[model samples]
Target: MQIQDLPYPDPGVPDVRSGPRFLWWLGRNQLGGQLTSLAWGLLHFMAVSAQPFCVGFAIEAVIDRSGARLALAGGLMALFGAATALGDTFLHRTAVTNWITAAARVQQLLARKASQLGSALSRRVAAGEVVAVSTGDVEKIGWFVEGVSRFSAAALTVVFVCVGLVVYQPALGIVVALGVPVVAFAALPLLPRATRRADVQREKAGRATELASDTVAGLRVLRGIGGEELFLDRYRRASQEVRQAAVSSARMWSLISAIQVLLPGLLLIAVVFYGVHLAREGRISVGELVTVYSSVMVLMYPLRHFEEIAMAYSFSRPSAKRAARVLSLERATDAAGSRAADLPSGDLYDPATGLLAPAARLTAVVCGDPDAAGRLAERLGGHPSEDGPSVLLGGVPLDELPLEGARTAVLVQDKDPVLLSGSLRDLLDVPASGEVGPTEALAAAQCADVLDALVQGSLDAGSPMDAHITERGRSLSGGQRQRLALARSLFTDPEVLVLDEPTSAVDSHTEARIAEGLREIRTGRTTILFTSSPLLLDRADRVVLVHDGVAVAVGVHRELLHTEPRYRAVVTRETEEETARGGVLKELHALGDAERLGDNERQEIEESA
Candidate 1:
């Protein structure tokens, strides 16, 4: 496909059997573009090859003192020169297009795989590896793809030139023809070494990239904990390893390059020496001798493509293998293990946790451990854990439903939801049911202040909705970002919404309002909330106390608070801390009041104090 028609309507299913197989699949998909590039490449190389022949003709005409032949020779030279220019220009343009298009196609496939895998992708693949594949590896792969056609064209031109020389003058032609292959294949022995070194470099580079990514992602936390230097030192070591690997790889390629240069020069020397001998013996004319020399000189340019092909393959093979490895990953049941099932309308039940939230009701789960809460929330949304039967909706396993069907039926918002960079309006725009509007969702999630902040941050914006958000909503406070994310999820209006600590970042006043709004908005839908906040639990229709990993008790918030000591301790820790702080403040105030009192009055109240 052409660049203009890029971002393929469907990137098509990738064949991830191996690196070579994946490369072949990419080539097969873009046969049209490859062929077009090949045609232009052939034209360019052929025109260039004809220049030596034309020069030979002009030399012959000059020697014969023939005006007609001279004029004809000059005309042919001019014609071929123009053809050469035209072909070279178009060939470059087509080659670049092929490169970009192939990269775009691979990017599309990676993106599609990421979407299909969802949160599972991050679990299966390293963030740095994905970043490396998407950024550098993609270009390397595209480079090899574009090089193929050019190399083919160059090889073909060498073949045609060899035949022409042999037909014109066999004595000199045979020597040059035999010498060309030597120059072309002389570097083969070093290619395997170069390729192995390149693989080492790529692997080291990928690890360095991963280290850098991890360091940057947690830079804030590292600084807070005074560990920034520790991470920096670690990253420095990784960077050094990468540099060493790269140098080793470069050395091998340099050796290959030397071979390419050395063999061609030796071939040129051999041809010149043999051609002069043939001319002295009167076996060939002076013009034919010049033709032979010039032909060898022109052949040098095309022969360089051989080395380029080797270098390109060496670099791209590892990149393709990494890409293929990532693409080959599949969710536990997303492969052929599961069949599409109809979306079910019933209670959401996690067999692992033995937690069931009945349909059309707001159920709250009180889990003291945040990690366990997160896992349960994921399960409720049909994302299975490593060692558990998939969550079931009604009686059918959620994993059995088609991916899109499951997503439409259940939405899970983890504690830390990401806010992608975009305008406020675009941020809220998602593939969602039309039941809820952005305004209603924002209001329900208590994001009025967030909207005001957005508008105030960008005064020239058309409206508050037009204000742009920074990546991950870094411009907003933790609570503000959480509310906006909640608003977005609320706008989706899924049939069953599973939230983990949705209001944890906000103050109790805001959290209380959000809990009320949440209950109101999800009047007839199934909503499961995993939190220990009394403000939210008090608003649930029913509360489930999950004590280790399983639901231990089921009751209303107040009932659990009085009857379940474990539940009360888990939910009342913040309240107890606040009460203790209040007591300390009261005693401090009493001491200050007594200090202000007269000595006699202080002594009268001293015993009570």
Candidate 2:
């Protein structure tokens, strides 16, 4: 494939059984590119080998005092020079194209896997490992692939050169051929040691990278807690470990490089010494001696390729293993189950927990165990999580429907929703068929204060959606980020909206407004909220109390508070079952005024704003 035609239409499924197997699979996929590179490489090396032969012939012709032979040799030499130039240029072009194409294909496969696995990807592989594989590992893999053709051609060129020397003078040729192999394979013994060092270096580097990533992500929190120096020290130790490992690996490789250079240099001396001794004995012509010497010197170029190929394999082998591991990650799913028809329009019922939210009704679920409440939220949204019978939507098993189909109808917002870094418009972009305008959705989620804060210091008034939010909304207050997540989720306008403690970060005033806004916007759709707040719970059409893995009671907030002790205990974390935020909204204006008065603490100013 051409370099311009990168990202192959289909980067066929990788053979992930082993690193070597995966490497083989990569080579097999780009057979056309590999062959094209190979052909050009062979031509280049052939021309390189012919150069020594031509030089030798020209020397002999000059000695014979034959004008015709000199003219012929000069013409052949010129032709070889032209061939060498063309071969060298095209060989480099093809090798680079192969490298780019191969790297592009692997990148595409990785990107596809990342999208398919989503958040689960981090659970399977470390973030640093993924980064290493995509960057350094991919480059190493491509380096190996790009070098294969050149290595093969160089090896073949060495063989042809040896054969030509042998044909010219048998005695010297035999010694030259035998000594070439010795120089070529001398570094083999050091390779194993070098490869081991490389592996250690890679592992240490990966740990260091992971440490740095984690440290950067939590830098703000660390500084707040006065523990920044602690993490900095840890990172320094990790960095030193990586440095030591790298130095150790470099020492072994340096030894191998020295041997590669030393062996060839000694062999060249032997060829020259043996050729001189034979010339004095009249065993071979002086011209023949020169020819044999030139041939062996040329053979050094190919021998170096042998060393390069060894290093390439040593590095790419482990890289291939890492890449294969990432490609092998498959999401927990059933093919046959996913082929079933989509859920039509009806209630969401979880048979495993016996919790049901009727169609077009706002149902609030309160479970004492937060873990159980989280899992229940997953079920309500038809997330094919681990264990239990499938949750049904519109009389169809949720797990049986395609993932995309299930997500289309049910939208779940976890308590800790992530606000991705981008402009406000980009943050709200998601996969949903229903069209809810940004203004309408923001109004429903009571996010007016957030917009005001975002546009506070900015000049752009024409569109607040264009305003930038820092990575994970680090620049924004926690409460403001939470409101933004809720607004983005509300904009999806799905058939069912499942929210888990979505307004926990907001103040009572904003929470009350959100409660009313949510009820009004979700007037004709199913909304399942897994919360324990009495204010939010009081607004639900029906509150389901999940106790000990079962739905124990279903009723209004006040009715259940008076009727069921367990329901009251679950909803109210306090044993007394008091509304902690009761009458809190009466001080809404006061709270805002206090924050406005203390400009220094503006960072903690708003939950909704």
Candidate 3:
């Protein structure tokens, strides 16, 4: 397919069982592009081979002083040169198109999988590994794909030249043809070593990349905890390991390259020597001998195709494997059947945790282990459950519902939410049947400061809503980004809102305001909150204490605090911080208004918030 055709109308289901199979699938899809590239490549190589034959004929004609023959030979040479130029130009264009199209297809596949996986994406794959797969891995796969036609044409050219030489001078031709295989196979033994090293380098590089991404993502936290140097040192060591592996890989490839060059040069020398012997014996005409020698020399250039194809496969194999792994990741389940077309309205129930959010009520879930809380929150949102009871909405299996349908019925804002790079308005853009406007969602999420910070960060802007946000809102402060993420989720206004520690990064005062706003905004809607914050818990219609991985207690927030020791312990700790937070928050307000807080200054309040 051509670039003009653009993102494939349908990327089609991929054959992701194995790397080579995936590569074969890509080639199959781009057959038109590959065939066109192959045809052009053949013409280019044919013209290249014709040049040596023309030169041999021209030399013979000059010796005979045949004017007509000389003229014809010179004309043929010019014609071939023109044909070579045309063929080379088109060959490059078609090859490039094939590369771009193939990469685009892989990109589409990755994107589709990523969207299907949603919040579970980071859980399945490292952020760095995903980045590497999408960027470097994709490019390598494309490079190999584009090289396929060129390599095929080159190999065919070598065969054709060898056959022509055999017809022109059989004895010398046989030797040259046999030597071609020796030159091509000489590097085979070294390839295994080189490929292994390459795999090592790629693995090390992926780790380093993942480490760097984690370091950058948590730079704010590291600085807060005075662990910048610690992380920096770790990254330095990782990067050194990556560098060392790369050097080892390069050394092996260099050896292979040396062998490739050395063996081909020896073949050239052997052919020339043998041709001279033939000339002396008068076994072949001088013209034919010249043609044979030149053909072998030309053959050397095309024979390198074998070496190139091997190297391309070596590098691309791992890349395709990574891409395949990404593509093959099945969503929690095949998009459950029978989507809730018009937002299924009912109580949200999790049979595994035995946690239930009655319709039109705000239920708080308190988990001692935050990790457990996150998992439970995901399950509440109908994120794949391979075994055990499925989350049910309106008595239907939430896991059995289509992805879009489940998303419409229940929306979960994770503990750590990301804001994609775009304008403020664009960031909040979501499919919500709710009547809540941007202003309402922003107010409910307590995002006034977030809007102010984004407005100041934007280059060209009107209202704060029109301001642009950087990728993942990195330019924004922790609290600002958190509030913005909340605002985006609130705007969606789904039937059931599952918020896992949504206000963990904001201050106590801000969190209080958010709790108040959320209660008002979500009136008569099922809202499931997973957090340990007392201020948020105080507002829940009912609270469920999750201890040792199961729901052990369910009651009002105050009753649980007065009764359950485990619940009281977690809640009281936040209570102490909340008291101190009041004074600090007042001082913060005295310095300036909330609007004065830039996105960068909004620190994450604390971990256990």
Candidate 4:
């Protein structure tokens, strides 16, 4: 079976039985490569085992003192050496290829699962956990899978050598065979303890990795709040805990290694002692005794694989479990059998809160809780929800529409919009098409000065539209990134554009210009601006003050200010305080009258001309 044909575990499924099963899954996917690797490993081990027999033959040939026998022994040695060299080379090449392919397959599976989960992945699993599983865990899993073929060949070599020894001389052969098992099985008792220690070590290492990732991502915020040292100290403590776990794991493995050396040496001694007795009793000939001794010595080599396989499994099982957990995260589900319906060109309704936004009219929602506002925006944009009322665009249920279709019709630009790396022009180019152009979008977003500033810095020296942006637009200021995000959203020109605190980052003057530009650019399109800014609110055709998640009052901004005290208190807090201070209110009232007069004059001039 090819890798493509292998059954990838479904992310929604929870049970994953064993490490060998996972390895078998990997092998089935790359059957041809695995077979080639296994064949090479068997040939390599066979070649290695042939060396001892050749040495034994040479020793016996010299004792015989025959020219033909010596020549035959020399010929066998040469053949064995050449074969061993060739087999070793091919074995290494195949083994490394197996390792790389296995790693790549796991990586491909992980990347595909991540994409399938989309935004829901981060919600289900921590970002640091995902990173750990992909990088460190995948490599360990590959290591275990590649070790399987090599270890199997080693065991086969040991078995074949023991049989050859017994066939030549039974008494000596029995001693050698029994000694081999003793050397290999001596390490079994300590393996369970070693494995447990290794598991603890790996878990601690994953935690340290997670803590470091979180620290780096939030470094700026931590420093801003004067908590850098606190987090640093916590990370240092985590690092120490990982160090302790590593030391404990090392101690267990070190004990295993000591036993691996000592038990094998004792077994070789017992075999040689027993073989000497057999020769004294004349039960085995001198040539047979030499072969028995040589085979016993060589059998020690394959016995080492017992320890290696134990260690590989000790590391791999926990790693596979970690990877499996990551792969098992379920993606968010949409309602079954819900189909997209035609949206009405009238009021949008939310059945849960019993709210409606009249056709082509500006509507404001004033929610007491900030989270409630965010949830409302998500519902308005047709994100899947279980508890809330279905949001209806026109009279059509928003959730019933296909994702792409709903997204095109209504866009909810969140408060903290992500700014991808790019120059001012590239940043403003949403959908990044050269057709809509950046000039108009930037002006509408009140980002003309931002573009000019970038141009002045030689940042826009090349084709402005093609200029590179850094990741997350980290190079730009917070307010600049915000406005650029706004510009990109405006470029999309969707039917119902929902802005959540769109003007929060900009100054009052720029905010006012953005409000005026929005009214002009989105003339007939339904737009909802979620903000308590008086400048933006006064420009709205209607305002809905949402208190306790319900739309309580709806009217023009000025009308709501007079009729609803809660609405007036919410929007006019600063103005009311200014009025108490005497001159500030007079200045604001004069500015408001000036803006009204300017609008009247512009209207009159347009009418006359």
Candidate 5:
């Protein structure tokens, strides 16, 4: 495909059977591009090789004292020069195009897989490994992909030159041809050692990346617990291990590079020594000797591609394997049951937890165990569990619906929903029913303060909606990020919106406002909030108190608080939860407010809280 046609309409289904198979599949898919590049490579290398022959002919013409033949030889040399320049330019263009398109295809496949797996991706793969695969591994795979066609052309050029030499002069030609194979395959024995070292380096690098990512994600927590040095030391050790592995890998590759250089140089020396002897004995003409020597020199150019091909394959093989492993991951819901023909429109019933969230109403579930609450949210969104049957909606199993269907029917926003880096408008621009606007969703999620912070923090002083958010929304406070995530979820306007502790980070006043806004915005739609805060529970149309993964009481917030002791205990404990936010959180919240407030005002807000 043309470069303009890239990012492809489809990357096509990949062969995840093995790494080598997947690499082969990528090459097969881009056969047209590869052929185009190969054609250019052939033209370029042929022109280059023909120049040495032209030079030899020029020497012969001069030695014969023929002026006309010399001019013709000069003209042919210029013609080959022009062809070489033209072919080289186009060859580079096509090769780069192949590389970029190959990388884009892999990126698309990885992104599609990540979407399919959702939160489960983190469970199956290390965050660092995923990051490494998507970034470093992609480039390596693309490098091998783009190099393959060039390597083929180079190999063909070497063979063509070898044959030309054998026909032109047999005595010296035979010697050169015999030496070519040895030079080409000289480093093959060391390749396994080099490849193994590269694999070790990649593995250690991935581990270091994962450790660094985890440490950064929990930096605040580590600092709070006075464990920052502990993690720092761990990360330091990981980084050192990565460095050591990289050094070891580099040594092996260096040895291979040395062998490649030394063997080719030795071949050149042997050719020169034998060619001089033949010329002195008058076995070949002066011009024929020049031609033979130049032919061997020109042959060295294509011979380098041999080592390059080996190196590219060594690095890309493991990278392709990692990408293949991730792509091979199947969503649990896919194998749970057969596809449901229609979207279910009714209560979400989890038989495992014995909980029912009626349709077209807001239901609040207060699960004592946070883990159980998360699992329930997962099941409600069609994530299968080996513990029990899949959740049902409208008497149809949720797992029976296709992944996209299930996602459309049920949207679950976990307690710590991630915020991808982008403009505020882009973050809210998700796949939705188009029933909710950004303004309304922001209002419903009580994100006015967040909007203000984003605008105030903008260095460009441009549109507030265009303000850039840092990766993971680190620029915003925990509460602000939470509200922003909630706003994004609200904007989707799904059939069923499951929010787990959506307002946990915000203060009680903000939480109460959010609870009321959620009730108003989610009216006439199925909404389930897994929260213990009385503020959120009071706003629910019906409340279910879950104990030990089962619904033990069902009533309004006030009714259950008075009638059920377990419910009362959970609700009262919310006060202690509020108080626990006083120590380090007080400082964190104060620092967040300090971005938009004066010191005295921030201090007052913190004191009042």
Candidate 6:
């Protein structure tokens, strides 16, 4: 099945209902396995109960002095032993199958939800919390779910054993039967405390995981600024908190375990004492007293199941809650009947900022605040947000389109694009299609040098572009990754492309080439370039200077530089500052060849009829 086809209902707002409902949903999905497990558990418990009866019968037969009776009792005991062993084995097998299947289903559901949400998933929930749910929480919930059948069978066995004893030897049987339930249930009071501790432990663990992930992702930057030690110190403190929380949780569980053992022992003692009193009074025979004791001993096994189920539930409840919280994140909603097909394909506009880009125009947006630009880029790409005016494409609201459709129609290439691990070819093969050839896309993004570098560093015995890239393209330089990202977007050939500072990482020459190539390749497509580079802005058909969330000026790049002092100052910071120790013109000229041979080759190609 495809990843999108996996079953994952939109879990609504979390309440007390969410955890129980999720469990119930899982049980319903695996009802057949659950029933099979329950049947086997009952059969297993019955076989176990019969062992005690066989032992008591053998004792009575020995007293009667009948060889035939003794032989029959011995045969019955051996038969019950084999039956009990087989039953227990099958029961455990069936129960474990149920546990694994249930966990797998929950994991599948969680994975599907994560994929559906895409980048939005981490925004709504901590990365660590999502990690914990998929890993630990799924197993805990499955354990509790499977334990239900075993505990039910155990409870039923205790009832039947009690009734049998009451019929055979009423006096001692009543106390033995009544005491089991009390001892098993006595641990309930501690469960709430245990669950609370478990929740706290899980919370702290998620925080520690988030810290670790963040530290690892920013490790290079941290080390570059000599802040690695500071982050390490913070992580160490967080790890200690997680350890303390885990210890606290473990202590509560230990207390519960002690009670599970102690209370059951107390009940066994009470049963033995009562059974002896009845035998002395001649209310029950010696063999029957043996039966009474054996039955109580057998009852201990089932009673243990009760305590185990309690513990399992205590641990799983909070885990289930955490899983539910992630599943419950709301997806962006569109108006009824407003499907992706209805979305228009002309100029994109943002009403909040009053910024309009005519169709097929190369528009440059200049914003003083980078954060505002980022937010605007998101909105322009149809990302859901509460604080912005709606973005429209050809007068149709962009938010009304389906996610996939909107993404295909309008691609947003962020400044720092995420690079997934794969071969160079695989890395550039996002949203996989064959519209843009590899060589052409590379040339368009001015990535020939980047490709050559990758080839030089290839460790595999294969074509360089086919060489495997590490996770997040960590093996490649930052500028190479960025250019590769630009190449990928250029390959997509989206009708409307929004690039946010796409050339921020590259050198001036490479940046200028990229800007020229981008304009040439996307000659007829509507492209929005968000950058402060004069080289890029100079090529744009129109440059819009945004101040305080509104577009204040719209004109050509050179016109804005001459007329709009704000736009000019924003772009040419070094040039405007008189106090700045500007480099000598001769020194600037030595930086690079002003008219490189590569530029001449590109210009010749452009002019070729």
Best by TM-score: 3
Clashing pairs in 6: none
Residue-pair clashes per prediction, in order, are 0, 2, 1, 7, 0, 0
The better candidate by TM-score, 2 or 5, is 2
Model 2 segments more than 4 A misplaced: 334-343, 349-357, 365-391, 398-400, 414-420, 457-461, 530-535, 542-609
Q: In candidate 5, how many Å is residue 471 off?
A: 3.7
Q: Write the per-residue lDDT of candidate 3 for residues 336-384, one digit (tens) a residue.
A: 5665455567888877878878999999999988888888887877775
Which ranges of candidate 1 are over 4 A from the true structure?
A: 332-343, 366-376, 385-389, 507-509, 532-535, 543-609
TM-score of each: 0.85, 0.85, 0.91, 0.75, 0.84, 0.85
The residue-level lDDT of candidate 4 at 54 comes to 74
Worst 10 contiguous positions by lDDT, candidate 6: 578-587
Cα lDDT tens digits for candidate 1, 280-365: 99988899989989998999999999999899999999999999999998655543326565568899888887898999999999
Q: What is the lDDT of residue 367 in candidate 4?
A: 60
Report the backbone clash tally of model 4: 7
Please estimate how well model 2 matches the true structure, expressed as its whole-model Cα lDDT: 0.82
lDDT of 6 by residue, 1-609 (tens): 112333435322223258877777777766776777788888888888877777788888888877888888789888877877887897898788778777776787677676545555665687778888888888999899889889988888888888888887788778876877777788788888988888888788888888997888777778779999999999999999989999998998888788878877887788778778877888777888888888877887888898788878878888888887787764453422266474478998988888898889899999878878887777787765765556888887776777666777788888778888878877766673466677778899988877777777776627768877778877777788889999989888888999999988899999889888999888888999899989899999999999898899999999988667678668877344421222222233466643454766544533441
**How does model 3 score by TM-score?**
0.91
Per-residue CA lDDT of model 5 for 273-390, tens digit only, reads 8888989999988888888888888887888899898999999999999999999987666643477557879998988878999999999998878887887787787775755688
* lDDT (Cα, tens digit) per residue for candidate 2, span 234-305: 999999999999899888888888998898889889888988999899998777888888877777777788
* Residue 235, model 4: Cα distance from true site in angstroms: 1.3
Instruction: Judge candidate 6 at residue 512 and give its lDDT.
Output: 86
1 versus 4: better TM-score goes to? 1
Tell me the lDDT of model 5 at 65: 93
